[model samples]
Target: MSAALALRQAIHDRLAADAPLAALAGAVRIHDVPPADVAFPFVILGEAVVADWSTATEGGTEQSLTLHAFSRAGGRREAFALAAAIQEALHDAPLALAGHRLANLRATTAEVRREGDGRTYHALVRFRAVTEPL
Candidate 1:
């Protein structure tokens, strides 16, 4: 598999197996594409941008991954809390990618805001990762 795909699979597995995160967002609430009637305080795997980072001797890739947390709580607190949990779960996480070596992973940016709908809060956490063929 491509490095980006491997890395994404590894991340999704890690997040799904995280007990603390499950406690906060509820089991089965993390999704690649959430259902139309998904529950609150759920996490969605968002966009991913991948770029070639190969050297003369080795092939590699750099990836930017985004995760979204949605909440309908009365305040931004729930969204922020979910974002923090996601950061803690992913930043510097030692994920084992299929057919690839995870060289590095880190949380790069995060934003929490009230959506235009005015009742929902959205939290976006972005991560950077480097991977190489194993």
Candidate 2:
């Protein structure tokens, strides 16, 4: 499996398994896109971009992942709280990738914005992760 795919799955699985994440979001709902059957207050594995970070003797990759939090708690506070849980869950997280080793993972930035729809809050968390072949 490719590093990007493994890392993405690892991330999703880690968040889904975290107790705090579930408590903060009433069950950590993580998906590339939330299922139509599901309601608001969930986490979306928004997008992932991978680049080569190889060295002479080692194969390395750097992945940028964007995680989005959506909530309908009457304000941005709930969304922001969820984002914090996500950051804490992922920052320097010890992810176990099938074909790769997670060298490092760090939360880059988080921003809270009221969606134009006016009924939802959008919180975006950017993460930088580095991986190498096992």
Candidate 3:
């Protein structure tokens, strides 16, 4: 598999297997493509961008991953809490990527805001990672 795909799979598996995260977001609430009738206060594996980070002797890749947390609570607290949990789960995590080595993973940024609908709160958490072929 491509480095980006491997990284994404590893991340999803890690998040899905985290007990603390599941407690906060509920079981199976983390999704690549959320169902049409999905509930609020869930997480979505959002966009990903990949670029070459190759050297003369080795092949590598840099990836930017974005995960979204949605909540319809009375305030932003729920969304922010979910974002924090996600960051804690992934920041510097020792994820084993398929056919690649995870060089580093860090939570880069997190933005929480109320959506235009005015009732939904959205938290966008971004992560930066580097991977080298094994």
lDDT string for model 2 (77-112, tens) is 899899999999999999899989999999999999
Error of 2 at 98 (Å): 0.6
List candidate 1 segments past 4 Å from native: none
Colliding pairs, model 3: none
Comparing 1 and 2 by lDDT, which wins? 2
TM-score each candidate.
0.95, 0.96, 0.95
- Report lDDT per candidate: 0.89, 0.91, 0.91
Q: TM-score of the candidate numbered 2?
A: 0.96
Report residue 16 deviation for candidate 1 (angstroms).
1.0
Candidate 2 segments exceeding 4 Å error:
none
Candidate 1 residue-wise lDDT, 15-66, digit = tens:
8888878887776377889889887878888899999999999999999999
> Ten-residue segment with the worst summed lDDT in candidate 3?
22-31
Q: Which candidate's TM-score is highest?
A: 2
